[model samples]
Target chain A: MKAAIFEHAGKMVVEDVAKPQIQAPDDVLIKVIRTCVCGSDLWSYKEGDHKQAHSMNDGHEALGIIEEVGEGITDLKVGDFVIAPFTHGCGQCAGCKDGFDGTCDNHPAPTNWGGGYQAQYIRFHYANWALIKVPGKPEDYSEEMMKSLLTLADVMATGYHAAFCARVKKGDKVVVIGDGAVGQSAVIAAKMMGASRIVLMSRHEDRQKLALESGATDIVEERGEEGIAKVREILGGPADAALECVGKQAAFEQAVGVLRSGGRLGYVGVPHEDNLNLWELFSHNIQVAGGSASVTTHVKNVLLDAVLKGEINPGRVFTQTYSLDEIDQAYKDMADRKTIKSYVIVD
Target chain B: MKAAIFEHAGKMVVEDVAKPQIQAPDDVLIKVIRTCVCGSDLWSYKEGDHKQAHSMNDGHEALGIIEEVGEGITDLKVGDFVIAPFTHGCGQCAGCKDGFDGTCDNHPAPTNWGGGYQAQYIRFHYANWALIKVPGKPEDYSEEMMKSLLTLADVMATGYHAAFCARVKKGDKVVVIGDGAVGQSAVIAAKMMGASRIVLMSRHEDRQKLALESGATDIVEERGEEGIAKVREILGGPADAALECVGKQAAFEQAVGVLRSGGRLGYVGVPHEDNLNLWELFSHNIQVAGGSASVTTHVKNVLLDAVLKGEINPGRVFTQTYSLDEIDQAYKDMADRKTIKSYVIVD
Candidate 1:
């Protein structure tokens, strides 16, 4: 089977790898239809690499068709188009029952035997609970719809998690830190939740335009304290809620800095720097929340219906697309700041 | 005027100080009827002192009578008894408008010219917004009621702030991670918010008893990892919400550790240690919030009514009392852990 393997920093190669097989009764083999290069992928793409020699492919989001299902699966079957959330849960663990499937006690990410979703064939564990079955086969949706569906697996749902955790509500003034796909998606989510003003921090013109179209009411091209001042100036004060989609230290500071005294912050950026100052949040009466996105929960409960109804076009975040053979270029384009997100059609 | 001054480490002296006068149009002279030794006061009492040769009194909580109202005062009048929240706000700033008067922009605590409330007479600034009227004279209420009213000024309201920030909804399994007056108050607040189970972390029999009486359903005496294990054992899993009242690093870790994957933590302890690890919170999907209590907001909107109706007995937290002359003993006893809280009588 062909899969995109992380060769090293500054390198991603599509090469032959062993085809994945179901090892558990609850598992299913998914033939990938669409996947993408995540902003998080840039972490390994630039500094370190997740894979050593002959290691599995590395990706987390996927939209695919089930090619085979194990006997223990009760609700789903083969040939069904589905959206596979990056983190699969057993659906019965305490974390799962409490609506945090991303942290399922029975199936932590490290225990998964399946290779990454940036592959032609991948085994999805806990298929019965983790996979959200689409309404029809792959031919039922257009390329744009397929892209949106793929995002529901991770990015779009993650964006929604930020807004949801921040408790964004009607008439709220929102500040989104980061202009990546996830940040753009957060602007959409905040708008959907009735935020009166949405400010996107972006210096890039293309990303800024997409964000504005998605729901951002304003934009700040500045960074650091200057950026915070701009947000406050635009809002006439501090914002009600801040969505942190970049994991950098400055992003965290910017997110915390632009909020009002009793404001809330929802951070989705995978923390690469330990820079969150509890003292700041404490003294200012700020509420801080958000971890790994509860992808399956949001996808099944919100994103699916919204996407099906065309209420949101999160797929617009993918400004570039690639074929399986062009996987290296996809990573390069994103790492070089040439694309908002790289959509990969792998079927 | 007589006031309690921090002479040095392990010493408190009640000495003559200049009588306070209304310096601001929004200020009033308060003839303090009751004040108390706060746990926070011990911060200065043990390691350092807050006063030099003739510094103002060292206390924040006060139940008093308005002896003279400023020309700008609108609602309060002379001779009216009131509960003066430790932190006063202008009531019109963005912080106050957002229900966070504790962090009011126009009148941060450093701008306060009034001596501390541990004096016979002190100036209460932002009088119209910060002082909550008691509906009658100080003598109209019993000694116990006065103690409870004094608690409303800071301790009780702070505990309520922990619970409020934790979002302790009905039927929640809660963990109160401190056995002091604030923790006891948090237990009461959690109960009022309809928590099904309240677990208090305490080693002291007296505080444990008080907590149980105040609505704590369980008590974990162990500290650190053992404490978290004990709480999980009692609750059958991690808690839904945790109230960190001690503000120590271990307390924050314990509060965060014993919570379920998506649990909420409300921390009220003045952070003496910068120990909040954002990575831990990020990985666990936990929400952290709380700050200095919004004393004025809580006193007016909830505590006053509850205390007046005899629905709560926060005064029970003050197990010992001392006269103005015995102010030194009050700090000594509390510092030695001889009292849950120390109540001082003045007029």
Candidate 2:
């Protein structure tokens, strides 16, 4: 198998490697169909040649078809298309039983993800519960549509889980900070969950458009004080709920700033450099912190329904899709914001 | 009229003062029946009080009877008993509309009560909404029971509201930090709301006994490291909900340490200091701060139900009471913790 290998720091090269095989009775071999980059990927991508740790493929979001199933795999068989979360849960940890499958100890990510910018394949443990079978393609899932659903395994599912964990309910006025794919997906999720109005803060044009189309009723371009005030102006005060999607200091501040008394703030964006203000959150009585997206628990059912109802067009987030050979250009196009999201088509 | 005047630092004496009369059309003249000392009252009591704003009478919790009602007051007439919160809302403030009448603009305390201890009567605004009518008191109520109900005007109500706001449900394992009147009240509230297990933390045997009698199934006498470990041992892990009843540093830490992954911590204890570590909260996905107790919104109903059913005896909380002439004794009893709470009979 030809796989993208991180030969050394600051470099990745396409090289011939042994194809991934089912090592356990519960493992399933998935033929990579499509995958995209995650923000976490940028951490290594930024470290660029100075550290060590990358041993296997780097990416976590991928949609593929099962090529072979271990004897223990019962729910899925060869040829069934599936969306796989970055890691699979064994479906027995107390956490996994309660829908937090991502935190389960089963089949922890092998310490050998040498490179994420790869195009090959990987086998999953406890494949039945981890690999969600993508039933017959949604009524009209063209290649582009499938690429969009591909994100459901990571970004979309994350956005949705953030809101769900925060307990956002119908008639809520929600404020979403950051206009990335996850932020855009949150707007759609908030709307689908019956929020009366969704306010998104975005200065990026392409991301802003996606937010609007996904159900954002109000869009503000302010960053800090002005941004919070704008949200207050639009919601008539602070919002009933807020989703923090940008893992930046400014976005987290803005997310907490515009909440009404008793309002909840669901934060999914991982903090990188800033310290959270306990005084602000504690005194103001805000409930904060919802963890990462639980895509494994959601990707399958959500995609099937979206495909059936035509309610959401996940593939529209991809502004460009390239062959495995165009990976570098894909990264650059995405980093520069020239594309809402870039996808890599794998066969 | 004679009043308990806080004329200067460390000085409070009974002095002649003007009688209160109705001002607004909905105002009511209350001949205070019982007023209790609160920890907040000690803010001035400990400061050795130089009359704040050239005024005295620092008490914020009181229960009494209606001596007179303004023309617009229809809910009560002369001789009706009532419970009043410290701050009186005009019943029209946005805070009042949202059931957070604690921040009401007009306030419920007497105008003559600009600062310090007092013995006269009070003038209440929007009497109908500002005053809660106590119902079905036993024919001969114990002075202690009356004082306990008086504390409900503040601490007890605050505690109950905190528990309710945190959404403590049936079968939930609840842990309460702080054995003050508020924390004790929270134990009762969580139990009333159907929590299957309640843990109360307190070093004082008296407070722990109160907790056990009220409803707490377990008591953790340890603090810091030992306290947290004991709590986990009792509940088998973090509790489902933690009612933070002590505002002090140690109490806050204990509260945060004893919650399940998706647990909620309702903080009602007013922090005597502001230092905090929000990252601790954010890391575990703990939902902190259920907002200040909206006691005014539930006081009337709680008083009526508890008194009518005899299911709860809030009055046991008051261990001491004094006449208007001996206000100093009441304060001393509370200061020494010789009394869980003390009430001053003002009539």
Candidate 3:
């Protein structure tokens, strides 16, 4: 099996690795069909000096076909197409039952194969619960549809989680910070959730255009207070909800700043700083919510059907694509902000 | 007019002050009938070195009779009994219309008379909206009802806001941190909102008794991790909602600690510290909300009707009473933790 390995900061390699084997009764092995470079992966790629060089798994998102099913897996079988949630859920824990499988207490540990789904073959523990089976094998979907389906594993669902956490509802005015793939996806989510107006904050023209097409009603190129003022100007007042897709401190503050008093903010950028001011949130009465997305729950409940029905085209976020051999370059493009998201065709 | 004056930290006096006159077209004069010493007032009483001596007006809560109506006041008449929310709101503003009158955009400034509702007579600004009519003069109600009505101005409504912000619902397990009057009031609010299990964290015997009587199903006498442990033991898991009625960082953290993954928390304590860690909240998916209570909205809509119907008894939190001349003692008792809440009778 060939997998992308993190050798150190600013360096990665695609090398032959041991194929993952089913170690648990509920486990299943999947051949990776599609994967992508996430914004979060850049955290270690750019400045992970404290991290052990080459000891961590590289990817969490993947669309795959089951090559082998363990004896305990009753609901799925070999050759079935599937989408794997970034964090596998056992489906029976209290967190899973409550539709927050991202915090599933009984979730199986990451595979001991020394790599992740960015590989040719990966093991999925508790396959019966976490894997969302597509109606057919990977070859049945168009290239565009495949890219969209692959996002259900994490990015699209994560974007949807932002809106869900912020309590975005019909006729709302929303401001989405960070025009990366997740933020663009949030624009689509806000539209699906019936936001009356959507504002995407972006400095890049390409990302801004995609966001507008995806349902952003407006765009602000400014940053900080100027950015907040622009959003308010466009919406005629502070927004009803703010989706913080960038984890930087400035983006977090801007999300808080653009919200109306007694407003709501959902953040999913994966915190790079820890300077939250409770006093500001207290005085403004802003409801703050967001975390790792409940990918499995969102996929099984809402997104899978929406994707199959063509209600959303989240695959448009994949502005660049690469072969599995180009995985290292994929990380570089994503890290340099040259690509909104890098899609890798692993098969 | 006799009013409570803050001379300095640990020093307060009852002195004759110039009577407040209608300085704004929207103001109304009220003869104070009942007021209470709040937990927040003690912040200045114990450690207010930076404050100018004798500069700050003391109280914010009052049940009173309208003494004089300003020229602009139309809905309220002179001699009508009313409850004045601590923060007066203009009825027509966006915040008021949205039912968050505490953040009303057009709220009138504090009266210029240099005194507050702890006085014999006080001014009610934004009279048409923020003042809730009691349907009769103060003489029409008994001492018990009067005490309860006074709470609607701030304490009881604030407690309700905690529950409201936390989204407390039927059959939910709730944890309430703080043993003050507002916290006890929160226990009542949790019950009213249909939380099946209410855990009140209080080491104080008097406050615990009052909270238990007010609808707390269990009491956790411990603090920190132990308090959280006890709450889990009582509820069999982390709580579905947490009401942070004390504004200290420890109280805030405990509120966060007791909540289940994806739980909600509402905080109303005037924050004495500012050390909220967004990382913890983000990871656990805890929705943090709350600020100054929308007192006028709660009093006008839900609480007034509930109080009038005898469906709640929030006045039980008033464990001590004093005449207007004993105002300084009222502060001392509340500050010393010798009283749950101190009630002041005025005319």
| TM-score comparison, 1 vs 3, better candidate | 1
Tens-place lDDT per residue, model 1, A174-284, is 999988989989999999999999999999999889998898999999999999999999999889999999988899899989987778999989887875676787778
Instruction: State every prediction's TM-score relative to the real structure.
Output: 0.97, 0.83, 0.96
Better of 2 and 3 by DockQ: 3
Q: What is the lDDT, from 0 to 100, of the residue A16 in candidate 2?
A: 70
Give the winner by lDDT: 1 or 3.
1
Error of 3 at B274 (Å): 1.1
Per-residue lDDT for B1-347 in model 1, tens only? 98888777777888888898999899999898899988988887787744464455569888888899899999999989888888887788677787777766676553232348898988888999888899878768898888889999889999999998998999999999988889989999999999999999999999999999989999999999999999999998888999999978999999988987779999999887765677788877898988878888888889899999999999999999999889889988998889999999895
Query: Which window of 10 residues has the lowest lDDT sum in candidate 3 chain A?
Result: A106-115
Query: Which runs of model 1 end up more than 4 angstroms from their true locations?
Result: A49-54, A109-115, B49-54, B109-115
Interface RMSD score of each model: 2.4, 4.7, 2.9
Error (Å) of candidate 3 at residue B301 is 1.8
Candidate 1 residue B289 C-alpha distance from true site, Å: 0.6
Better of 2 and 3 by lDDT: 3
Q: How do the residues A73-96 of candidate 3 rate in per-residue lDDT, one tens digit apiece?
A: 999989898997776667885556
The model with the greater DockQ, 1 or 2, is 1
- Lowest summed lDDT window (length 10), candidate 2 chain A: A108-117
Chain A TM-scores, one per candidate? 0.96, 0.90, 0.95
